[model samples]
Target chain A: MKVKTKHIMNLFYIPALLLFVAFVVYPFTQGIRISFTNWNGYSQAYKYIGLDNYIRFFKDKNVLGAFVNTIIYGFGSTIVQNILGLAYALFLNSKFTGRSVVRAVIYMPVMIASLIMGYIMYFLVQYDGGAINDLLILFGKAPVDLMSQGPRAVLIMTLINILQFVGISMVIYLAGLQNIPEMYYEAASIDGVNAWGQFKYITLPLLMPAISSAVVLNLIGGLKLFDIIMALTAGGPGYSTHSLSTMVTNMYFRGQHAGYSATIGIFTFIFIMIVSNIIVRYFDKKEVEM
Target chain B: MVQNNKRAAIWRTPLAIIIVLIHFAPIYILLGMAFKSPKDVTSRWILPGYIYKQNFDIAINKGNMLAGLYNTTIITVSCIVLIIVFGALAAYPLARNRSKFNGGIKAFVLGIMMVPPLSILVPLYTVMAGLKGTSTYWGIIVILTAFQLPMSIFLYTNFISAIPTALDEAASIDGCGPFRTFFLVILPQLKPITASVVILTGINCWNDYQFSLYMLQSPKIKTITLTISSFFSQNSNNVNAAAAAALMGILPVILLFLSLQKYFIKGMVDSAIK
Candidate 1:
């Protein structure tokens, strides 16, 4: 009976495992293989020119730009998101009426897909009669064409990304704040710790676990930023706002650079693997000490 | 001290309110302008003088919003149901059995949760095409299921393990087989995690654009996200109609979120922090 029950339990795993292997493992391996080739994505004939695709990718100006932009997007958004999120979470942790409503409102953007949010942002940022420009005109100031510049466009993209996701970090931080014993705060208050001191010594230390998770999750999400960039800028005013993910999509779908696209994908896979693992390890150690 | 606390609330609450308002400003613009005519939408008016019904008509008739909505509903519902069922079932054995195999599977699922789907985009699309999965509802469903499975399983397994082992023993002693015990005794107890899985996966599959962009390229099979996206690009000149399409497309998901926000927020925090 025990053996049969064990077999049945294993049987339950078969469907999920099969689909996972086929869809995830198989394609992942194929992506690696195609990266070493010189396939144009149309004709069946192609040759594996070892390391040439990776070599070209390293040399390509656009690829390098995208790599840098992805890093900026990831780190830039992660930093801003954590700071703002922690602040909001701390504020919301205080007693107030309509608190849940406020949290839901703040988190509302997180529910909207980034792709749609990007489209809405485009309307607001457009130069001619855009909402932001119109608001500026109302204020008797000259309108700024924000998205026209490469750096500014990337900055706005990062800001938009931050706005959409900060609530997630906030919610996470709030959960962490809830986990801390109230007696700690009470004891600190009795001992005459200032707000800043209490926060620095009590809240911040207690919140480290939440901080690590939020930062790493946000970092991963920001690195994978694509739909928003695609919808808002299409990696332009030029290729200035392109992340590696968007660049891969563009290379494969539009530019007909299949092998090159796979190479970028592989590069992204390895890079993300290294970066995220390093972050997770670093955080795991911090969490233990805290 | 009480007075000081009151004073702090006065400033803190309003500041929090401002932050939320700022976050929602774009959505407000999107909805406000969606009802205006093209001229009024582009103008400096905060709200339209009168609502124009033509925007919705145009969105439905021309922008493919209706067909997209229909397809999106089918896909989202089907995907959510399958995710919950499969995720719970797979998580069960892993949660109950303490073996090296289960341990490896758990770790692999967690690792897959971190992998960016874009890393395998080209090959996944190619393989899907070979299987004739592109442009088909089931194909996209399968892909979404596979991609979302790791997270689903992780959440479910964690939740299930917290449930007591005595329930399984109780069911088995009552003359139930493993499958019957699972379906009858264990499955019903999985409501909370199942709710989490539903909201998380529903929002994901509903709002998905990247996969739909490549897989469901055909006009007839386009999801609401794809429809709204293509409409925005094609009709950039007509701001009102585009906003209308966008508004209509997002309304369902927004409504769903609003209704289940308690679960939604809890699920998010639960899934992430674990």
Candidate 2:
């Protein structure tokens, strides 16, 4: 019976394993191999120059800019998302009339695709006839062209991303808040611990696990952000706003520099692996210390 | 104390209402503008004066929304089915066994969840092109299922562990085989996680843009996201029409989410903290 069970267990693993190997593992290994060659994405014949792509990455201005922008976007959005999400979560956790309605409205955007949100925001941020501009003009102010400048465009994209996703962290944090045993708060209050002290000492410490999850999830999502950037900026204003993910696609599909694009991808992979590990470790340590 | 509590409620209630309004401003503009006539679209009117139903017609007819909807439905449904079935099957063993092999597989799936999909896009594209899988529903469907599987497996494994091992023992004592035990006993209890998996994967597949953009570039086979994006770029200046098209594209998913709000939130929280 034991042998039969083990065999069936092995059998159950086969389908998912095959799909993962074929699509993910195989493509990743091939991506590594392709990055080393000047293959151009089409012709069979190509020459490999060891470390040439990696070496080129160090000197390429656009790549270096993209790397910086990626970090800024990653950390920038992650920080804002956590702060706002936690605030919203805390607010919603308290009793109020129409709380569910408010929660639904805020959380609705999280369901919509970021790509769609980007397009919608494009209308809002444009100089002419934008909803924002229209509201601005209603206030007797000049219409600002928010999308024309590179750095500004990047900021808008990041903000749009944060707006669309804040609800996710909010919902998660709300769940965490709900899960906390009410006894802790009651105990703290009985001891004359003020609201802020109770929050700092009991609430915050107890919520570390939720904080860790939210931080890591948002960081990874922000790091790998593509759709919103693609729809909103398309790495425009001379690639100034491009994150590494968008830059990789722009390099390959439009630029046709497949080999170099793969190099960008490989670099991004390594960067994420390193950054995510550090974040997970840092959060894990904090959780333990608490 | 009663006065203080009442005062706090007064401030907090209005504040909450304002926050919801601000957060929902974009969607409000999208819907409000979508129904406005062309001349009225750019105005500061918070609400449209009249219901302009023709915009939906333009979005549906001009944007090829029917085809987009068809393609998106097929892809989303297939991806959800595969994710649930395969993810659950794999998770059962990983959750049940205490061996190094299962341990390694669990770790591998978790690791893959962290891999940025963009890193592997080029090779994935090439492989799909070589296999003639590009532009086909199955082409994109297979890749999405693979990418989404990790989360499903992770969630399902965590959920499955909560099921007592004694259930498996009881099944074995009855004359049930391993597969039957899982199907007859274990699978039924997975309804909650199953709902979670379905809600999460459904939204993902419906909303996925990057993979569909790369894989399904053919004009005839665009998903709703790609279709709306393409439509907006082509008619960039037609704000009313673009807004209409955007609304049309997102309405189905919005409806789904609204209807399944509880399950969706449960799924998201379960997947993340696990």
Best by lDDT: 2
Off by over 4 Å in 1: B41-45
User: On residues A9-46, what C-alpha lDDT tens digit does candidate 2 reach at each position?
Assistant: 76787899999999999999999999998878877888
Q: How good is the docking of model 2, as DockQ? A: 0.78
* lDDT at position B206, candidate 1: 87
lDDT of each: 0.87, 0.88
Relative to the real complex, the DockQ score for model 1 comes to 0.69
Worst 10 residues of 2 chain B by lDDT: B37-46
Superposed Cα deviation of residue A283, candidate 1 (Å): 1.3
Write down the worst ten-residue block by lDDT for model 1 chain A. Answer: A1-10
**lDDT tens string, model 1, A133-231?**
988998999999989888889999999999999989999999999999999989999999988999999988888889988998899999999988988
| TM-score between candidate 2 and the true structure | 0.98
**Candidate 2 backbone overlaps, count:** 0
Question: Per-residue lDDT for B215-239 in model 1, tens only?
Answer: 9978889998899888988888888
Over B1-274, each residue of candidate 2 has an lDDT whose tens digit, in order, gives 4687688788888898789889888888888888988766446347887898888888888899889989999999999999999999999898888689889999999999988999998999999999999999999999999999999999889998999999898999998887998899899999888998998878889999999999998998999999999988888777788889999888997898889889888888998886
* Second chain TM-score, each model: 0.96, 0.96
